[model samples]
Target: MDINKIHYAEITISAVSPKQYPDDGLPEVALAGRSNVGKSSFINAMVNRKKLARTSGKPGKTRTLNYFNIENELFFVDVPGYGYAKVSNAEQEKWGEMMNVYFSSRDELSLSILLVDLRHHPTELDVQMYDFLKYYNLPVLVVATKADKIKKSKRNKHINQVIQTLELATEDKVMVFSAETREGRDEVWNEILASTRNDSI
Candidate 1:
C-alpha cells in the first residue's frame, strides 16, 4: 500500500454482462455515484495515477462497467454514473438494466464505495442506491468527494447533511475526500483493504 511504489493498473475490460467479467474471482469493489460526482477522479486518486480513470468535463461520459486491475490483487469496478437528464430515457433504461443485472448477482462484488458530493445533500437517486446496497447486505464505505472545495470550518455541516440524507447507520463508514489534494486517499485504501480482506463485513 505504499503510494510511491509502482503499481500495475489497467482497464481489464468494459463489461456489459456477467459473462464478460473476469472469472478468477478476485474480490471487487464497485464505485457508484451521480453523473458528475468524480468517481473516475476518485479511482485515480486511490491508485495514485493521474489518468488511470478517465476524467471528463461532461457528465455521463462513462457508459459501461469498467474494471480496473490494481496490482493484480483487486478489481475496481467503475459502474456508469446515474442521475443525468441529458442521457436519453432509453439509454438510461439500458444502463439501468445493465446495472440491475450486475449488482443483483455479481458474486465477486465484495464492497461498494459510494461517492457523494460534499457540497450538497445526497440526492434522491443517491438515497435509492444506498437502500439498494443495503438490501443486498453489502458493506458500504461512503466517500464525500470534492472535499477541497469546502472550507474546513463548514465541512462538518455538509458531512452531516450527507449522513442525514442517507440515514446512514452508526456502523457505516463515511469520510471527506479530495482528488485534488489526495485527501483521504490512504484512509480510503485502508478501508478498502480492510473491507476486501475480511470475509465477513
Candidate 2:
C-alpha cells in the first residue's frame, strides 16, 4: 500500500467535552497505552509525520481525547495514556471515569490500538487496559513498540508473553513496531486500514 497519500486533515482536543462528539461518518481508531510508552511516537510514525501527536518524555502530558482525521477516511483518536503520574488521586479517578465513558459509549469508534512496550512484558496497567477494551467488546490491535530496543531472539519471547498475558487468540493480531526507526509502519497502517474498513457496526 502506498502511504505517501496519507496526510493529517484536522485535529480536535477535548472533543468529548462541552457536549458529545457529533456522529461523524468517519470510522475512528482509538489509541490507548500506558504513560510514556511512546503512544505519540507510534501515531507520528504511522502518519509519517513528526510531532503530529506531541511526543513527550514526561508521563500524563495528554489529558484529553485528541482526534486527528487521517486521509479524510478515518479518524485517529489519541486517548490519554494511563498509569503513573504526579496527579492527585481524585484527578486520576476523574480521568478513569472519563475514559470509561468514552470507551463504553463512543459510537464512531471502530477499533482500538493497544500500544505496549516491547522491551518489557505487559505491565499491570497494560493488562487492565486489555481487559477493559475486551470488556467493551471493542476490537483491538496490539502494537508492540520499541522493538529495536530488544534483541531479535528475545523479541518473540516478549511478544509471546504479551499475547499470553492479553489472552490473544490470533498470532497475526500482534504487530511489532519501532516508531523511532520507522519499522513496521506499513504493517501497522495495513492493520488500521483493515480495521477501519471492517466496521462491524
Candidate 3:
C-alpha cells in the first residue's frame, strides 16, 4: 500500500489498562521511545495528520497507551516515553508497572517500533528496552529520528553506532527518518504494512 493513500486515522482510546484497550482484535503496532524522541510528530507524519497525536514541549507527556485506528486496518499503540529524570521515583515505578503488564501480556501486538535519536548512540535505557522486546519475542523495527539534523556524510556513522550499541543483528531492520523533510516516510508505511501482513499470516 506504499503508493496507495492512507486516508483514515483517529485516536480510538487512551488506555491505562488492558481492559480499556480496543477489543476489535486488530493487529497493533506499539511505539516505544524517549519523551523527546519526536514520537508524536512521527505518528502525525505517518497518518498525514497535523495533530492526530498531541505534541508537547514537556517530556514524559504520555502516561497511557494511546491507540490509533488506521483505516480500520490496524492499530498504532503509542506507549509512554522513558528516561526522563525530572519525574519522581514513584511516578517512574508506576510507569514501569504499567508498561510491564502491558508488554508482557498484549497478544494483539503485532510489532514493536523503537525510536532512538539518529544524532547519538542508543542509550543504556534504549538498549534495555530493545532487549526487553526481544525477550518477549516481539519483532522490532528500530527507527532513528532527526536524520535531517545531521550531515549526510556522517549519517552512516550514526546509524552504525546505533547498530553496535544495541548489538542489532545484521538482518535486523533500521530506518532513518526526518520529520522536516518527510524522508523515509513512505518506506515506514510499507514496513508497517508488511508487519500487518505478517500478523495476518
Winning candidate number (TM-score): 1
Error of 3 at 139 (Å): 0.5
lDDT of each: 0.89, 0.81, 0.88
lDDT of 3: 0.88
Model 1 lDDT per residue over 39-132, tens place: 9889888888889898998899888999999887789999989998899999998998998888889988888999999999999999999998
TM-score order of candidates, top first: 1, 3, 2
Model 3: residues with Cα > 4 Å off, grouped in runs: 1-4, 198-201
Query: How would you encode candidate 3's per-residue C-alpha lDDT over 1-201 as one tens digit per residue?
Result: 333467888998998888898888888999999899999999988877888999999999898889999988899999989998898899888888888888899988878999999998899999999998888888899999999999999999999999999999565699999878898887787788787874211
- Candidates by lDDT, descending order: 1, 3, 2
Query: What is the model-wide C-alpha lDDT for candidate 1?
Result: 0.89
- TM-score to true structure, per model: 0.95, 0.91, 0.94
Q: Which 10 successive residues of model 2 have the least lDDT summed?
A: 13-22
Instruction: Mark the regions of model 1 whose C-alpha exceeds 4 Å error after superposition.
Output: 1-3, 199-201
* Candidate with the larger TM-score of 2 and 3: 3
